[model samples]
Target: MNLNAIKYCLRQGVVSLFRNFWLAVVTAGMIAVSLAILGGFLLVALNVGQILYNIAGNVEISVFLRDDADQELIRTRLDGLDGVREHTFIPREQGLTDFGYALGDSALFAGLAGENNPLPDMFRVRVGESDMVEALAEKMRAFPGVEFVDYGEELVARLLGVTRWLNAFFLAISFLLAASAVFLIVTIIRLSVMARQEEIGVMKYLGASNFFIRAPFFLEGMAMGWAGALSAAVALGAAYHRLAFSLQREALLFFLQPVTDPEKLWPVFAGLLALGTVMGGLGSLVSVRRFVRA
Candidate 1:
């Protein structure tokens, strides 16, 4: 179409919004609430995910070595182990020093200083999967020169269980939210079509092409969806930042740290906007099918 045709379509779309002001508001409000709920849960899931990552990061296996073990060979074997991310070697003297530090004073280890160190040489190995930490530890024990491997097996297993449940819960909630949003959009668009039935018939009788007759309604739906998405984005962004800042201030809640940057949320905002627009367009198309032959 030419510039004038485009302008006319745009004007019609804008005018429709005002003509049915209450309907526009209601539709937009429903979408905004739905998106806000989805966004809120999404933020919670992300923050919780960060916490899980922190927990997993803090878990590492300690592989103690025999005094006569070949440190170089053990290191080489560790490098080849599946799921191993990294490993740090600790000499017997350094292990003693670390033990002393843990016990809090030189007096705690005065009798076992320097060459008198009784601690075994060890390796701190970090694995890629928290759930696999215990399995990896058991596997490490079977390796040559490995005296024993310990990784707080019970703790890692419990943490993995919690994280798995959290992920499953979020996925279920997300599916429900998406389904509800789609149903609401379809119903609202059907009501909108019925409200504008007379005008649509008049346009059809005037020989206007189906595309021209339907363009305004489609744009109207998109306008409402876009407005809702924008509102939800603003609210969610503000709330996320506020919560993140508050949580960060509490040392005990450090593990629950959230991503507060608005710039980082652009992709999420974009996804919501796209989802809104697509739902709106689909709803309008489905609702207008009957009027097409008018």
Candidate 2:
């Protein structure tokens, strides 16, 4: 196409927007609302996943030992364990003292400091990965002198399960929202084509190429979709910023801290724009092809 042709196509594309002003507005509005809901859900899933990740990282296994257990044997076995990252041996005395300090009254256990201390000697073990916690705990349980191993096994399993479920749910929601947006775009573009059928037919009779006839509709669809995505991004960003700010100020939500960095969200915004643009182009291509013959 020549410069003149390009200019004409561009002009026609822009004109199409105003030609169906209400339709365009409605299309853009639907896109914006759909994308906003998807983005909001994505943000929530991300924050929840982060919280679970942190908790998993801090998970530790406690191996309680009998009073007659050989300290050197236990330490050697722990050092040789495949998934063991580190281990700290807590003598009965230290364990009692630590327990007392945790209770916020060290004096409460001062009398039990020596022989009266009921706390068993234990090894606090940190695993290299969350998935290895269960296996490592089982191995430690079999170690000589090990009375029992406690690492909240059921809790860790539940946490990992929840993370997997959240990921699956997010993917399902994303697919549905994207499909709905595409369907709406297709409907809007098809209506525009139907409204201009006579004009398109006349241009075809005048020897206009298919590309020449299709360019305007394609551009119009893309503009509508992009406009909607941009609006959604702005609205969602503002809301997320306010939410993060409020979360930071609340003590109770300290553990549920959100993604506070605005820069991190740039990629998501870019993705939304790309998705909208692609959906618009595809919808227009599919809609116009039926009426604009080669």
Candidate 3:
């Protein structure tokens, strides 16, 4: 289409929105509500995933040694092992002292000092990769003089499993929300087309191409979608910012830190806008194809 034709279509689209101002508002409101819910869930899922990731990254393997185990030999082997980021050897006495400090009751273990200490010498091993933790722990367990290895294996496995399930849930929720938004947009466009049936019919009879007949409806759908998404983004961003500020001030939920940076948020808002615009255009295309014939 020529520039003038495009301008005419755009003008008609804007005029149609103004003519049906209340309906347009309702359409935008519905779209905004749907998007807001989707965005809110997405933010929550992202933050949870990040917290899990941090916890997994800090996982450490504790290798306890038998009393007769050759500590120097085990240390040498550990140094040669792959995926072993670093290892700290804790003597039995030091281990007991550390435990006492952790418990904040040194008097309870006061009699257990020196020869009376029952704690075994242990090596605290940090793995370079979380995925290799189990393998590394197994290798350490096989080492001569090693009593056992404990790395909170169950906890790490559960964390990973929870993260996977969360991702699947997010995908399902996203699909449902997107489908609902598209359906809402389609219904709105169909109603708009029905309201202007005679006008579309006259345009079709006056040698106007199918594109010319459909362009205004397409623009209208996109406009509504864009406006709704913009509103949702602004409202959601403000709410999240306020929430982050409150949490920081109260020193609550230190583990699950909310994303408060505008630089990070702008991209998400842009993505939401793009998604809304595309859905709007697609909904318009579907409605016009069926209602505005050549």
lDDT of 3 by residue, 62-174 (tens): 99999999999999999999988899999998898889889997677989988899999999998776668899899999999999999988887887788889999988998
lDDT of 2 at 57: 73
For model 2, residues 35-85, the per-residue Cα lDDT tens digits are 888888888887876787778878899999998899999999999999888
When summed lDDT is taken over every stretch of 10 residues in candidate 2, the lowest stretch is: 260-269
Tens-place lDDT per residue, model 1, 148-227, is 88888788888988988988998798778766766676677677677777888898788889888778778887888888
Error of 3 at 36 (Å): 1.0
1 or 2, which is superior by TM-score?
A: 1
Error of 2 at 277 (Å): 1.9
Off by over 4 Å in 1: 1-9, 66-68, 77-85, 96-120, 128-143, 202-214, 261-264, 289-294
Q: Which ranges in model 2 have alpha carbons more than 4 Å from their true place? A: 1-5, 62-150, 206-209
lDDT (0 to 1) per candidate: 0.80, 0.88, 0.87
**What TM-score do all the candidates reach, one by one?**
0.79, 0.76, 0.77
Q: Ranking by TM-score, best first?
A: 1, 3, 2
State the lDDT at 242 in candidate 2: 90
